[model samples]
Target chain A: MRLKDRVAIVVGAGQSPGEGMGNGRATALTFAREGAKVLCVDHNLKSAQETVEMIGANQGTAMAFKADVTKEAEIKAMVADAHSRWGRIDILHNNVGVSLSGGDAELLEITEEAFDRCVAINLKSCILAAKHVIPIMRAQKSGAIINISSMAVITTYPYVAYKATKAAMVSFTEQLAYQNAAYGIRANVILPGLMNTPMAVDTRARTFKKTRAEVEAERDAKVPLGKKMGTGWDVANAALFLASDEASFITGVTLPVDGGASVRRG
Target chain B: MTRLAGKTALITGASSGIGRAIATRFLAEGATLLLMDITEAVVEGGEPTHKILDVPFFQGDVSNEKDVDEAVRRAALPTGRLDIVVNDAVIRIGKKLTDTSLEEWNRVMAVNLAGVFLMCRAAVRQMLTQEIRHEARGRIVNISSQHGMISSPEDVSYGTSKAGVVYLTRQIAADYGRDSIICNAVAPGKILTGKTGRAVEPRWLDYSHARTPLPRLGRSEDVANAALFLASDEATFITGENLMVDGGWMAG
Candidate 1:
C-alpha cells in the first residue's frame, strides 16, 4: 500500500537468461503489489510480457511495452505511451546496464564500438529517459526517479566504459535532483554491489565459462555481511523505499545496496 | 501488513520533534516501544510523548552510562530482545568554535557523541546475546545531521559531534557485520520540527532556505520515515550508510 494509486514505469524490465527474478522485474512487481499501476518496458517484448504476466498472476496491475532505451525516439515514445495509458507518471526507474556481453574490455583492449554501445546503454539511455519524463513530472509537480548504477563506479572493475559511464550516472542524477527539486521531482541513484541476479552472476558465469555456483561463491566471498551476495529483492526493496512517499524529504542521494562491502574496504 | 511486528524497540529523545515522530511511526508499524528522554516536557511545547502514546517512559540522560544501560535493559525485559534502537537524543550548543566556552563544547559532545557511544555499546552487548531474526541480530538507526558532512555555519561543536556519529556508524558496521548487527545513520537537512530560539531565528531560516534546493523545508515525519526504513526488515542488507534526507541540499 506504500505506492497506492501511483503510476510507475520500469525500464529494462527483463533479464537476460536467468533462473530467478531480475532487479527491474522484481521492482516492477514490488511496485505493482504495493498498488502502483506499472508499465514494464524492455527491448525484448517477450521478456517484458513475461514480467507483466507474473504481475498479472498476482492480481497486480501492469502492462508490457517495448523500447530500445538507447534510441532517443524510442525512449520518447515509451514515456509518451506510458503517460497516455496511465494519464500521469509518478515514478521512472532506469535499470538498463551491460558489461562483458556488451563487448566491454579494459582501456587498451576496448574497441570504439564497445565504448559507444556501453555509453548509449548505460549512460545516454538514462539521460534520454529522464529528458522525456521530466516535463510530465513537472506538470504533475511530483515524481521520483530511481537510477540503477553499479558499485563498480567506486570499487575496482575491469571494464573501462562500464566504470566511466556508471560513475557519470551518479553525477547526472545529482544534477537532475539539483535542477528539478523545485519542480517536485526527486532523483536518486542506487549502486548495487556483487548482486546475485541473472544480470550479474549468470552473466559472469557465462562470460568466464564458469559454473553458476562458482561465480556465486566467488562473489559471496567478497561481501562482508554473512559472506553472502544480496538478491534482486534487496535492490527492489531499496527502490521501493526511494520511490515511496516515505522518502519525501530524501533526494540526490547515492545509496549503496551492498552487504557492507563498500564500508569494509581496506 | 505490519512491517515491524513482534519487534521490541527503544527510542531516545522521544519527548519531541523527530524522536516523537519516530516513536509514533514505530508504534503504527506494530513495534513494542520504550521511550527515553532527559525530561518529560517537550521542547517544541506539547503533551509528554510517552503519555500521548500510552507507552512506558524511562526518564534518563543518554550521556550517563547507567541511564543508557537501564533503559536498554527495561526495553528488552518484556521480549528478551531489543530489535531496534534509534539514537535520536542530542544537544546542540549552537556556538562557533572561537565563541564557544569549554562548558558549551563539553555539554554538546557529552550529549551528542558520548551518548551515542554509550547507547550503541549497551545495545550491541545485548544484541550479541540475542538470536538473529530476518538476517539481523539488531538494527541501530542514529539520527545524524547534514551539517556533520559540511559546515554547520556557526555551530562548530554540534557539527563535530555529528561527524563523529557518522564515523562511529561506519566503524560499528564494519566490526559487527559478522555478528548480524546493522548500524546506519539518517542525515536530515533543514527540518522544521517546531523548535524555537536560535534554530528558528530569521537569519538562520533565510540561510537554510537559500541552501535547500526544495521549495519547502522538511517535516519531522520526513526523518522519522527514513528511520523507520532503516529499522525495518526492508533494509536488511544496508549498513554503514549515512542516508541524506536533505531534499537535494547535499546534491547541489
Candidate 2:
C-alpha cells in the first residue's frame, strides 16, 4: 500500500487495437493495486472503461473519463473532474504516444499534416495537462509527475516528429522540476525502449505489413538484455517507483527502461 | 510479498550511513545477509549494524583482494549462491588538488575505485557459476554521487574515483548482459547521513541547500530505497544505469 489514499490521474489510459496491455493501462492498474484511487482518461471511452472494470474486479478504486488529450479544453476538464471528485491530486502519469498510427515517417517522407498531429497529440497534450494540474498541486504542496518519453530520444529512430518531440519532453521535465521544486512538485521522465505493447508492436506490424513475430524478433534482437523485448509491466513498474514515496528525493531524471540498449551506445 | 525474498546479498561498508541503511532494508525484505566493513564502529554512533540486524559481519578492507575474496567465499557457503553485491565502501580526503598529497589521493582511489573492482570480480565469478533467477544471474549496485557527473566543488580525487565507478558499472553490464548479469549505480546528492564532519559545516550545508532544488537535503533511507529497487526483481529490464536519488540537484 505504497500509495494508500492517494489520488492519481492516468492520461491515455487505454490501449489501441492490439494483443497486449499498453503502458498507460498497466500503469493505471499498478497505481490502483498500490491503493491509489485512479482516474483513467482516454480518447476511446470503451477502452478506458475496460481498464476501470479490471481495477474494480481487484477491489481497487477507479473511474473512467473520455477526453481527446490534444484538445486544450478536454485536458483542462479532465484535471478539474479529478480535482472536484478527490479534492486533491497526488500523481499525474502521462503515457500517450503514437508513431505509425499517427502517420509518422522519415524527414523527407513526412507530411505537414502528420507533423502537426504528432506535435498536437504527443507534445501539446502533456504541456496543457501540467498547466492545469500545477495549481492544485501547488496548493497541496505535493505531487509527482511521470512522463513516458521514448528511448528514441537517444537511440536511432526513423521518425523525426517522434524523436524531436520525445527529446523535448526530457528538457520540459527538467524545467518543470526546477521551477516547481519549491512547491513540492516532482517531475521525471521514463524512456521505454522496444516494449512489446499494443501501440509499440501492433501499429508497426500493420503499417509496415510485417508479421507480429517478425517485428517482435527484430526489436528483441536490438535489446542488450535477455535478447527479448520488455513488456508493458516494465514501464508500469518504473512509473510506480517514480510515482511512489520511495522516490520522493528523485526528480527531473531521464531514466531509460531500455534493457541496457542506451548504455550500449555509450 | 518481500521483494528480496530468497536472495543472498553482500553489502560493503555496512557499519554506517547509507550502507547500514541498505543492509537494514535488504534484510527486512527477506535477503540472507552478509555485512562487510573494515570495522564494526558506526559513524553516526550506536550499536554495530550486524549485531542489531543479527547478520554475519566480516571486518575486512575492500581494497585487499584476499579480504574481498574471503568475504564472497563465506557469503556463498550457506546458500551456494550470491544473488546481489553492493559496493558502498568509500573514503574521501576532502582536500583540494594542491592540498592533496600523493598519499591522500592514492588512499581514496584504492578504497573507492579499486575496491569496487575486486569485490565485483569475486562476486561475478560466483554469479557466473549459478543459474539465472528472475532474468538476472546476479546484480551489483555501486553507490555513486552527483559529483561524478558534475564537479565535486573542491574534492578532486573523490569525484574522479566516483567517475571511474560510473564507467566501470557500464563496462561490466555491457560485457555480462548475455550472461544475465545486471549492474547499476545509485547516485545520491547531498545526503545528510547524520555524521559530524565538514559535510555538516554551515558553509557547506548552505552551499548544498542553495544548489539543491528540494526544500531539504536527503536522508540515507532515500538512497537505500533506490538501491532496493535496483536490486529487486522489479527492475527487470534496467541495466548499466546510474539512477539518481537526488532531490533535483543534478536536474538544475
Candidate 3:
C-alpha cells in the first residue's frame, strides 16, 4: 500500500509479444499491487489491454489506452484520458526502449531512418510525455517521474543511437530535477543492466540468431552477482521505490538496478 | 505486511542519528535486531535506542574486530542466520587537511573505513554458512555520505574515509556477489538528525540549503527508508549501488 490512492501512467505498458513480463508491464503490476491506479498505455491496444486484465485479475485498478509515445497528440490524449478518469497524475513511468530489433547497430552501419526512429521512440517520447505531464504536476505541486535508461549507457554496446539517446536521458532527467524542484516534481533515471526481460534477452535472441537460453546464459555470465541476469521484478521494484513517498527526499539519482555490473569499474 | 518478516539484522552505531532511525524502522518491519554502538548515550540526548525498542544492545566499538564478531554472533543467535547487516558506525573529525592531526585522521579511518571492512568480513563469513533465502544469503547496507563522491566542504578526513567506504562497498559486492550476498550503500545528503555542534553549524546549514534542490533539508527517516529498502527482499537484484537519498543535491 505504498502508493495507495496515487494515480500512475505507465508508458509502454505492453511487452513486445512475449511470454513473460516486460519492464513496463511489470512496473504497471507493481504499481497496482502497491495500490496505485495505473493507466497502462502502449502503442498496441491489445497488448495494453492484456496488461490491464492482468492487473484486474489481481484486484487492482487499471485501464488500457493506446498511444504512440513518439506522437505528442497521442501522448496528450492518453494523459487527458487518465486525468479525466483519475483527476490527477502522481506518477509517470517512461519505460520504452529499443535496441537490435529496432535497427540499432554500430555508428557506420546504422542508417538515418533507424537512428531517427530510435531517437523518437526512446528519447523524444520521454521528453514529450514530460512536457505534457509537467504542467499537470506543477498545478498539483507534486509529482514523480521515473525514466528507464539502459546499462549500455555505461557499458559498451553495439547500438550507436541507443547509447547516445539513453545517455541523453540521464542528463535530461538531471536537468528536469534542477528546473522543477520548486514545483515539488521529482525526476530520476534507472539504468538497468542485463535484465532478463523481452527487451534484453528475447530481442537479442531474435536479432543475433541464437536461442533465448543461449542469450540469457551469455548475459548472465557478465553479471557479477549471482551469475544470473536480473528480472523485470528487479527493475519494477526499483521503480516502486523511486515512485513512492519513501523516496521523497531522492531526486535526480541515476540508480543502476544492475546486479553489481557497474560497480566493477569503480 | 511486514517487509522483513523472519529476518535477523545487525546494525552498528544504532544509538543515535541515522543509525537509531534505521534500528527503529527495522524493528517495525518485523526484523529481529541486535544493535551495536560504542556508547548507549544518544547524541541528541534521549532515551537509549536499545531500551526504547526493547532489543538487545552490544556496547562496543565497530573498529574493534572482536566487538564486531560478537555483535554478528549475537544477531544470529535466535534465528541462526544473519539476514542483514548495516555498517552505520561512523566518526567525523571536522578538521581540514592542513589542520587535521595524524591522530584525528587515523581515528576517523578506523571507525568509518576499517570498521566497515571488519563488519562486512564477519557478516560475509557468517552468511556463507547459512542457506539462501529470497535468492540471497545475506544483505549488507553501508551508510555512506554524498560528500565522499563529490566533496565534504571542510572536513578532509571524514570525506576520505567515506570515499574508502564507497569503494569498499563495491569491492565486496563484486567479490561476494557470486555467493548470493548483496552489498550496497546509501549515500545520504544533508539530513537533519537532531545532531548538534559542527553538524548544525550555521555555515554548513546554509551550504546544505543552497546545494539541495528540494524545498527542505532531509530527515533521518528519509535515509532510514532507503536503508530499509536495500536490506529487504524488494531489492534482491540490486547490489553495489550507492543510492543517493539526497534532495537532488548531486543532480543539480
Candidate 4:
C-alpha cells in the first residue's frame, strides 16, 4: 500500500529456475505486492515474461520488456515503452549485475576486454539507465533510483572487477543524488551480503569449484550471527523502503542488507 | 509471543530516549529486561516484577566498571544466562571545537564510548561463561549515530564517540564471531527525541525537513523496528553490521 499506484521499472528482472529469486524479479514482485505497476525488464524475454505472468496471476499490474541493459538503445527503448504505457517512472530499481571470475591479477594479467565487459555490464548500464531516466524524472519533479550493489564492495573479495564496479555504483549514487536533488529525485544503493539465491548458488558453484551445498555451508559458517545467509527478499524489502516515501529525505546512501556478514571477519 | 520470549536482555541508558524505547519494545516482545541508567530518577518508575512486569531497573553510571559488573550480575540472576545487550547509554555535550572544554569532552567520551566498551566487556565475559543454547550465542546492539559516519559540526566529541562505537562494533563482531556472539550497531539520523526536538533551532527545521527524503524526522519506533530485526532470529546471519534507521537522512 505504501507504493500504491506508483509506476516502477525493475531492470534485470529475469525469473530464475528453482526456489530462489534474483534481485530484479524479487523487487518486481515486491513492488507489485505493495501496489505498484511494474515493468519487469530482462535480457531474456522468457524470463521477463515469467515475472509478468506471476504478477498478473496475483492480480497485479505488470508487463514484460526484453532489453539488454548494457545496450543504450535497448535501455532507451525500455524507458520509452514504460513511459508510453504508464506515463511516469516513479521508481527505477537498477538490479542488473554479473560476477566475473578474476582474482587478484597483476595489471598485466587483467585483460582490457574483461575490464571493459565488467564496466559495461555492471557499471555503465546504471549510468545509461540514469541518463535516460533522469530527464523523465526531472520533468516529473520526483523519482527514486535504487541501485543494487554488493557487500564485496566494502568487504574485500577476490572478484576485483565485481568489487570495483560495485564500489563505483556507490559513488555513482552519491554523485547522482547531488546532481538531481533539486528535482526531488533521490538515488541510493543497496549492498546485499552473501545471499542464498539462485544467482548466489550458481556463482559460488561455478567460481569456487565447490558444490552449492558446500559453498552455502562455508558462506553460512563465516557469518557471525545466526550462521546463515540472507535471502533476495531481504534485499528487496530494503529497496522497497528506500523507494517508498518513508525514505523521502534519504539520498546518496549505501545500505547493506547483509545479515551483518560484511562486518563479520573470518 | 515476544520475539525474545524467555530471553534475558541488559540495556544500558535505559532511562530515556532510544534506550528506553528499546527496553519498552523488548519487554513488549516478552524478553526479561535489565535496565541500567546513570540517572536513578529517570528509571525509577519502570522496575521489573514477577507478573505483568518484565523490567529490572539498575541505577548506575555505565562508565564505571563496578556499576556494569553489578548490572550484569543482576541481569544473569534468574536465568543464569544473558542473551542480548543493547548499549544505548550516551551523553552528548554540544559545543564547537573552540568552545568545547576538555572536561566536557572527556566526560562525554567516558560515558558514550567508554560505557559501551565496559558493558560489552561484561556481557562478553558472561556469554563466555554461559552454556550455548542450540548453538544460539549472544547479541549486542550498539546505538551509534549517522553522525558517526558523517560529520557533526556542533558536537565533535559526540560524533567522535559514535564513530568509535562503529569501530567497536566491528571489532567485537570480528573477535567474538567464533564464540557465537554477534555485535552490531544502529545509527539513527535526525530522530525527533526530547533532546533533539528541543535543541534543533526552529529555523533549521524547514531545511532539515526539505532535505530529508522521507520528508519527516525519525521516531524512536523506527529505530526500535530495526533493533527488533537485529535481535530476533531473523538476523541470525548478521553480525558487525551497522543498520541505519534514520528515515533516509544519511541517504540525502
lDDT per residue, candidate 2, B45-126, as tens digits? 9999999999999999999999999999999988999999999999998988999999999999999999999999999999
- lDDT, each prediction: 0.93, 0.93, 0.93, 0.80
CAPRI level of candidate 3? high
Off by over 4 Å in 1: none
Lowest-scoring 10 consecutive residues by lDDT in candidate 1 chain A? Answer: A257-266
Query: Across residues A85-191, which tens digit of lDDT does each residue of candidate 3 receive?
Result: 99999999999888776798899899999999999999999999999999999999999999999888888777799999999999999999988987899999999
Writing each residue's lDDT as its tens digit, candidate 4 over B163-188 gives: 99999998988778778787888888
Task: Say what the interface RMSD of candidate 3 is.
Answer: 0.7
DockQ of each model vs. true complex: 0.86, 0.87, 0.89, 0.28
RMSD of each: 1.0, 1.0, 1.1, 4.9
TM-score of 2: 0.99
lDDT agreement of model 4 with the native: 0.80
Query: Between the candidate structures 1 and 2, which one is better when assessed by DockQ?
Result: 2
For model 1 the TM-score comes to: 0.99
| Total clashes for model 3 | 0
* Candidate 3 wrong stretches, greater than 4 Å: none
Local accuracy of candidate 2 as per-residue lDDT tens digits, A1-266:
88999999999898999898989999999999999999999999999999999999999999999999999999999999999999899999988878778988999999999999998889888888999999999999999999999999988898999999999999999999999999999999999988999899998898889999999999898888888888888899999999999999999898989888888883
Ranking by DockQ: 3, 2, 1, 4
lDDT of 3 by residue, B13-33 (tens): 999999999999999999999
Clashing pairs in 1: none
Task: List fnat per candidate, in order.
Answer: 0.81, 0.81, 0.90, 0.35
